[model samples]
Target: MGFHTFDIDRADALEDESRYRHLSAEELLAVLRPHPEMTVADLGSGTGFYTDDVAPHVGHLYAVDVQEAMHDIYREKGFPETVETVVADVASLPFDDGALDAAFSTMTYHEFAGEASLAELSRVLRPGGRFVVVDWTATGAGTAGPPTDERYSVGEAASALENAGFSVDRAESRTETFLCVASV
Candidate 1:
């Protein structure tokens, strides 16, 4: 099976499981404190994990996801009124240029519908706005987390963002994750 279909089963299972959900949200906040008041868009906000935690810190949060089922959870969980849940694809988000102060995706970039996702991410931020990407490392035995063919290391993701018109500020490996902070 192709990469797109490779994790369909796991993604479906994730919709009902909250195991990694809270931990991911906490990890996101750890890196985003400096820009706490900035408007943020939690792209591919599966289960509103980061959405709910981030809403309290950011000026506003656009909790966007392509899945209605996920959005329904956001609503049911009674996320702060500050969150605006929108149903949309990550690669083709329906946001406007310079409209966001920052954007974040946790363990979601590998699932990009295609290259258009990177372009869309670069297009929506203001010139100096930050883009924080937190995803599983694409190497080491922990590579077991994502399909080998579809993952990217921090270096690879940094290069892709640079190609998409971002000025990479940081690209480094964490204990078990890869992270990058870039400016559009």
Candidate 2:
């Protein structure tokens, strides 16, 4: 339902640029369709890595992470003025109903992937708002990212979203990761 490993010790690994090979910022922005006036949230935002990549495009961006220590590292690195850190779980976001214009999680989905979390996402995102997920897929060979068993396939992600009351727009797989986009 929520992330169990709130380890800040691996914070530096989150900053690795090589991760873009799995999901690039350009691809994320394209799928997210972010607007200048949009209020977005980076779900499971670790050290503001991908959050920083998205900040300049959005009017307001919430870096939501379960770990405050990760937010501390994000603050120390100095994020954009538009980026605000919110320490919270994916299953229990602090925002009101229909509060987010869009939300996304970068490599952190498996940690909080479940019906409750998906339902919470569906509850917070406004009608027609986008919710994109880019994470390691279970079908991939055991290489980088989390173990294959812990990951969700694109189909699983799409099915979970559909069950949670969101309409899945696109669900595709890469060599090691999957991209699933859903709309509220």
Write one digit per residue (lDDT tens) for candidate 2, span 49-135. 899999999999999988889998998999999999998888999999999999999988899989888889888999999999998
Give each prediction's root-mean-square deviation over alpha carbons: 3.4, 1.4
Q: What TM-score, computed on C-alpha atoms, does each candidate reach? A: 0.81, 0.96
Any residue pairs clashing in model 2, and if so which? none
Q: How does candidate 2 fare on TM-score? A: 0.96
Candidate 1, 11: how far from true, in Å? Answer: 7.6
lDDT tens digits, residues 1-184, model 1?
1334223334444444363542465666776653556878987786676677788887789988777777775577678877888887767777887888888877777767246777888788877888888776667456345665667788888888888888998888765568888888
**lDDT at 132, model 2:** 94
